[model samples]
Target chain A: MKNYSNLNLMNFLTPGPSQLYFTVEDHIKKALKENICAISHRSKAFQQIVVHTISQIRQLMNIPEDYYIVFTASATEIWERIIQNLSIENSYHLVNGSFSKKFYDFSVSLKRKASKYEVALGQGFELADLPIPEQVELLCLTQNETSSGVSMPLSDIYELRKKFPNAIIAVDMVSSAPYPDLDFSQIDTAFFSVQKCFGLPAGLGVWIFNERCVEKSLALEKAGISTGTYHSISSLIKNIKNNETPETPNMLGIYLLGKVCEDMNRRTIQAIRTEISYKAGLMYYALRESKNFEIFVKEEKFRSKTVIVADVLQTPASTLINHLKEHQITVGSGYGAGKDKQIRIANFPTHSKETFELLADLLIKA
Target chain B: MKNYSNLNLMNFLTPGPSQLYFTVEDHIKKALKENICAISHRSKAFQQIVVHTISQIRQLMNIPEDYYIVFTASATEIWERIIQNLSIENSYHLVNGSFSKKFYDFSVSLKRKASKYEVALGQGFELADLPIPEQVELLCLTQNETSSGVSMPLSDIYELRKKFPNAIIAVDMVSSAPYPDLDFSQIDTAFFSVQKCFGLPAGLGVWIFNERCVEKSLALEKAGISTGTYHSISSLIKNIKNNETPETPNMLGIYLLGKVCEDMNRRTIQAIRTEISYKAGLMYYALRESKNFEIFVKEEKFRSKTVIVADVLQTPASTLINHLKEHQITVGSGYGAGKDKQIRIANFPTHSKETFELLADLLIKA
Candidate 1:
């Protein structure tokens, strides 16, 4: 086995499209050798890949039996699909970051009666303050805000589900997945891109939705609404029954995802989560001790363990980013308006404990 | 150097995703080592990749100076984007095959006043026979329909441009891009997926459009119409100005496409097209001389050089496919309703002359 730790490769700490799993290179090579990318989506061989991938994902995530896992181009596309299919006229959003805000904007752009309970940057939603109207057909929530690194607790998600029993709850777990130990039965739909916690390449988004979401899409189609063309829930469900996609998908990505998820299953999700928590704790401790940086999220409980966002206090965030880059480590700058003032670091499973220790040392010294 | 020709790899003659270029494996390895998949889409490095790839594509395809190259999830998505952005109400389609027919369906699903000049599966449209209404805002054509291996001659496209000066002409070159000698100025917009002639993996679609398409999208947005979300023409154009995508794309696929195009440019497009014509000629001749198979498209002018469809006369198409599989070669079964009655073979740039000769021997013998 090659020593991934000692390999002369630049380690990426950016949230998503982040460092790939050590096994991904081999998986990709196997895919190429097996001619996976060349197979037709309609072929039984391609269908086997899709079926195996969905099964592996279910095993890894402990996905509910009632939920269906469908593929999309990206999590961004899923936001639009959700708005088109599940939302009738009214939808409610809990916006704490850029990605969550974009989902709300999608609903509005579709000429839906969309309303949101907005919070400041680096803050998670307060369940008591959420004003989800009974008439709202869908409630959009960001389980982990990728931009600001603010994560809503599982308790908050469960609480929202109780409060809005009739409304479909859609969760955006783009930057945090296979780690958030959530009860899938509590949420009607959830989505995450494989480029994130799955430690795979970009291009494939995994959307998990229950029967309620499917029934809603059928209802909208019956009402003569254009849910979507190829990627609508009804179309996806029809294809998924045959273990295929509505269009030619990233077959290589899907194949790699299955292999990676299978690898993850072998390692066990509990063990992976434990390692993630430890790495997050070490990094957080290092940031707190550093004179130049502090944790961006004020509330300790709200801080995302997956994506760590830090506010540069005494020095520019670029200085520390450049310092890490000099060591052949790549981290992310803050998103949107916080571009210069903060830096984001991903604590995904692909990132080893040794790599985190090296980054933590540099961050503390800086 | 790896002897790709002698390798024990199964040669795929499916339309697409067909055989990958010999250089793809090494390019993918380089991308993994360089951590291309992990980089931020907004980063300067990622922007460089995007710009370089677009430049290479322009060089290879002889795209016009005024044309802008934007990326989408797939060519299927591009059909919807063209309808949403460029068409106001009335759109006309030339439906030669399944893929072309789907574009018409997308427009109709969007509630556009869509009309089509339909033809038989293995037939191409006659320019004089087309009933293009004067009020039609868009004319959708398939330069080379992948489903039935029917191609519209460049002269037809140019004539359509002259006949319908007011209508936006959007061409689907999904299975024939980078190989089709198209005059970019004659068509307002054209789109293709990289999995086909580009000899890369799926998940990235290239949409080439001129300023007229952009202006139409802007006008639609101004009129309170929803062009799209995230990947609207306006959003893609804005990102293209910065050499970035509106969302996280298939970075690995894009990187591989650039390297392949660069490889193609180094070999010279004229030389590649010459080789393609030669290989296609050899395959078609073998099919014509064979006792078991015959050319599906009756008209020589309409037959696609890239995808060759053959009618099985003496044996079921599946028997030939199974025979090829036994020899570690894979050719596609006919698409849709003609599944068992016909076979499709792709004569893409990645397919070597030696490989084609070997397949030709089998085809002639069978």
Candidate 2:
């Protein structure tokens, strides 16, 4: 087992692509020295890396043994894949923020009859208010919406399983993954990029799905539906059995992800998750109690424990962003139309409890 | 400029994802220290990195100023993108090997009317032999086929543009770029992965397309056709103009690519191309003279300058592969079904003339 919790300067609290995993730099050095990236994707050595990485991920995240893990360029790619492979006639989206809305948009873009129950930004979907859409074969959910820092509570997210029993549930954990403690049995498929909670670089999306998604994907192909090429679910499953991808994937990213996952497993994800709770609590409390900022998500349970969104008061978001920059801290400003008004702060595993305490102190007075 | 020509043992002569560029290690070290990977893709700092990287790529490759350089996960993604965006009716492919055939396959998978004039393995197409397809909107060509170590000579590749004057020419330079000295005027679009000639890691793919391809993409989008989403041609162009991608991309890959390109530019691509020619000659000469092996491609003109494939005559490919491994040298086994029958040797810019000379001497006995 490797060590963890190396303190670094310059706190990056952006939602996704926030900070490098503490051990990632060390892992990268090892990879480069061994020419790990130069190895053929088909090589036995590459296969070992793929197998070890997936195994660590599964063990760390408690992903079921039956779930198949695949790699794609980004979580954004998964949006298209889910729509193309799992859904035929219609897809339902519980949209709250931009990232969730994009999943719905992708279904529509793929020419599927995509129906979305969109709430106000920074709000979560309530099971009681959600309308059951007709003939929806895929139910899309963003467990953690990065753009608005809204989170659908796990209970609410899993409760949809009963309502949308016939549909494939695809969860987007672009901002918060491995941290969500998701019930994989309840969620048929889920996807995430490394940059968010994993604290790895962008690129290298991890797409995990059970047999149901694969059966649906195979059915789609049988019906002459284009489930995509290269990194399609079918091809990914076929290639992954040999510990390879249909295309040469993000080898270095995978290498680092494996090492990072291993390191997280060393500290234990449970420990990391517990630390995340404390850090998220401190940051959210600071923002909620601040004179200069107010919590963006009004509902207590709706706010994401990973990404905390705050409405900047009596100042542009840039002021707070710059204020933190002076302290060598970086926090993301509001996304899209709320760019000048909201400040989104990430409380990822890469963020230390001590560092979060410092950031919370800074936020309290800023 | 930083110096190069460092001596390193344990040579990797695989086609793509060969040895990392000599300077890549230093650049990666610097990137890790500077927290380059941790930077936000939307930050001005990240925008500068993207701009600088794209600018360096354009200048190093002498790509036209009008050409739009976009990044994808792999060259495989570009094939699907080209079919989805540029070809609405028919895509004519000049297929000889696995990689080129996959490009045609992607068109078929996308449900495009893909026509191909496939020559024998290790053979290049003659202009007279091609049966021109009707209503072809895209003409696809692989300048260098990594699978069979065959290259369609630039003259022959450019000749197709004159023959199919109206169709968008999308060239696959997956294993050959910057070394090709490609005439941008004759090719509407071309793509290559960094792991090949660029000698970076495997994740980042550089997709270069001229205004014509973008115009076709826009026309297709205007016609309400699904041109895909996220990294769509239209979205890529729009996002790139703002120095952003529609999604958070391979930040570390882009950073390393920029530094590596800068190193290549400092050394000058002309010098690299000259070295590639010389090293390629030495490799081909070694293979041709060897009693144990024979050149895979019979035609001299069709032989790739970057990847040299040779038939294993007496011994299994592994025997010769193991023989080289004994000397701390690694070479690629033949691709696909030919794995035991052939050995492919990479002759990228990173492969030094001195190293190739040593390998050539070793191959004389193997």
Best candidate, lDDT-wise? 1
What are the per-residue Cα lDDT tens digits for candidate 2 across B49-72? 888899999999888899999999
lDDT of 2 by residue, A162-196 (tens): 77788898988888888888888898999999998
Native-to-model Cα distance after best TM-score fit, residue B144 in candidate 2, in Å: 0.7
Those runs of model 1 whose alpha carbons end farther than 4 Å from true positions after fitting are: A1-8, B1-8
Q: What is each predicted model's overall lDDT from 0 to 1?
A: 0.89, 0.86
DockQ of each: 0.48, 0.48
State the TM-score for model 1: 0.97
- Model 2 TM-score is 0.96
